[model samples]
Target: MRAIIIDDEPHCISSLKYDINLFCPEVEVIDACHNGHEGISSIKKNDPDLVFLDIEMPAMNGLQMLDQLGGNIPFQLVFTTAYDKFAAQAFRLSAVDYLLKPIDTHDLMDAVSRVKLRLNRDVSRQFDNLKYNFGRPFAEQRVAFPHRDGYDFVNVKDIAYCRADGAYTTVTMADGKSTLLSKSLGEVTEMLPVKLFERIHHSTLVNIQFITQFIKRDGGYVVMGDGVKLAVSRSKKDRILSLLGLERW
Candidate 1:
């Protein structure tokens, strides 16, 4: 896979390139740039398969650089940034891959793998999501749920619950709408923010805000806002109850 590294810090660029060379040898470092302008020119010239982009830079930040690209992006982007709480959250909501600075070999290799896997897939929406949410608060941030056909963008708060459907998951919105995800329940859980969602059963994931009441009968279930009863597993009972701040007694 042809790749490019774009970061203002020379050391960061060097370390990332070295790790890519050592661990992920399949990805060729086609070019490296010190700022967004050079990065844009390199992208136009190389048309690389993957780009490792740093968020902050002088004059033109990464987002601004992307805006300058006019949304005609063909390369997969994996953002690399120093750990800022909000910036990390924006990446997650954007459903784009990212590596925290002082990069780990494992994460670097994994990011490379993702880029190669999704090289030809559409990423315009992912870029849009990041750009849109970067300036917003966590509550206002929306997530782009990726399924087989494409992505379904929605507010995390609107998701009522998710049920395991074989290898895929079915996300039921609070308004009785549903979207099928091409990921397993476990995988879908990873996509959601943990603070607002909880696994009450091996087959069920619920948005804490939409849970109306807990029923002890029928192997224990929770009533959702839409009157759906989702079972709670025996093993996860105490922990989920504790998380919900509900007393079993």
Candidate 2:
């Protein structure tokens, strides 16, 4: 795939280009731009299949640049940012690819693979979702789950609990339906806001809003809104009690 690398830092552009050349032989770097201005012209001239865009830049940030480009962007985009959890959450909910600072080799390759698979698809919706989310409150923001073909966007409030199954997580909605996410439980935990989700057990994360009752008898478990009961770890019991504002029963 023909690609463009856009960043404000020269060394970043150089390092990313070198990495791409070394690891992703299939992704040719057609153009490397210093800032948003150069990036605009480079994009027009190169018309790359994929664009690696840095989010924060002086004069014109990536989001501002993208805003000026209008809504009908024709190429697949991968955002590069300095490890910010909130920003990454927005990207995930939008199904937009993002790489944190000091990008990992495995991560870059995975992003490339996902981009290749999603090529030729219209990404206007995803972009719009991402932009909209940046301005919205965390509680109101929706979560997007990646599937085999695309993503399933669901309201964050819809999730009742997340159950870990080895490397994957089973996200159960309040309605009792569950979707197995490719991400591990720890990874999944990062995607969720800690204000709403509590790690009740080593293998389970429960949405605080879904708790119906906390049974203290016989090892301790919380009954969810969906009538599902999940165990609470002894270490986390006090925290859960504090979160629920409950007196020990």
Candidate 3:
């Protein structure tokens, strides 16, 4: 499969390239980038099937780059880092594959094998679920909302809607206030109650209870109870209409 290596250290990239070629014969290393910005741009341009990403880099780190990708992240990420203590924890939390620095040949093979297994195992089904739930609503009540500093409790009913602002999500409250969340719209959407919220666009999720009116602009927009207008995607129009109990207008 096509793959790209992203790490700030040139030697790390060189070591990884050698390991992949020697141990994991199937993986073709198409390109290597020095930092997260170039890494992201390369991924967008090359559309590789897998990415070996380093956790820390200048300007944009690996996690930050993933956050910036939003719904458009094309490849399965295999984080390559020297952070030993957090490695096991990260894998446990997200089912993510990773390899440590000063790479071990056996570990490299194991990681590549796992990648192949996951990619071969009904990836289309996984993609389908991912698409349907891309920007699907959040169930705040059940989820422990995360802040940059730490986790906080958020009542599901307190949130009026969610707006994705490049690399961050703005959680608009019912009381006319907004909080910037560190999570992506997709990540936050999974935490929200789908029954109460629905993704109406690539960048927006609205509270079903707070919808004031369905304003059909030249494109389509939702008028909130507070007179705020939010854009809706054409792909989501049918779902939005169904939620509103209205036939096509």
Candidate 2 — worst ten consecutive residues by lDDT sum?
83-92
Best by lDDT: 2
Error of 3 at 118 (Å): 1.7
Q: Which residue ranges in model 1 land beyond 4 Å of their true spot?
A: 84-86, 234-248
Model 2 residue 118 distance off true place after TM-score fit, in angstroms? 2.8
lDDT of 2 at 145: 79
Which is the winner by lDDT between candidate 2 and candidate 3? 2
Q: If ranked by lDDT, best first, what sequence of candidates would result?
A: 2, 1, 3
lDDT per residue, candidate 3, 13-108, as tens digits? Answer: 998998888878899999999988888789989988888988778788877777677646557667887775423333322335667777788988
RMSD over all Cα atoms, model 1: 2.2
Residue pairs in collision within model 2 = none
Quote the lDDT for 97 in model 3.
62
Error of 2 at 66 (Å): 2.1
Q: How does candidate 1 score on lDDT?
A: 0.87
Model 3 clash pairs are: 138-192, 138-193, 139-191, 139-192, 139-193
Give each model a TM-score: 0.89, 0.84, 0.48
